[model samples]
Target: MQNQLIAFEGFDRVLNYGLDRLRCPSPVGVDRRIRLTQKVASIEHINATMFRVVLDSAIWIEDEDKPAIIASLIAQLHAAPDTT
Candidate 1:
């Protein structure tokens, strides 16, 4: 199945902001960005073949932060138990 999708689960306030940012550049509080990056890496995928892309809202992450966050998420995805 090549059709893959990404999903996020977390506190409503945070998820709302994260989703919004993913859609477009939007303002987010520092605390929210910190929380998002911390949780982004822990995503467990139900399907193992698809690479999960969890991006932090563009408001806070700049320079090295973006790459670090992405790398962390990829690491977590690889470490996740294969469910498929």
Candidate 2:
């Protein structure tokens, strides 16, 4: 993965984005959003099945919204083939 600095809610961390999925810095404390999507079954079924979008834990920490953006990007990439 590349060392790409992505800004979160108020923090910054290196986020790695791949063709199929994204690896986001894990959320700290009693987190719920990013932490909950650790499971394949936890993400939206469409994204999981079609785009194979995934969210996994990492050594870094950041805001939860970053993953949502990643997922959107992945879906757009996945859909690009038929659109253009």
User: lDDT tens string, model 2, 1-84?
Assistant: 312322123222223334344444433455543322232323333442133334442333355444332332221113322333
In model 1, which range of ten residues has the least summed lDDT?
A: 11-20
Error of 2 at 25 (Å): 11
Top TM-score model? 1
* Residue 65 CA displacement from its true place in model 2, Å: 27
Error of 2 at 33 (Å): 28
CA displacement after TM-score superposition, residue 11 of candidate 1 (Å): 30
After superposing candidate 2 on the true structure, give the runs of residues whose Cα lies further than 4 Å from its correct spot: 2-52, 60-76, 81-84
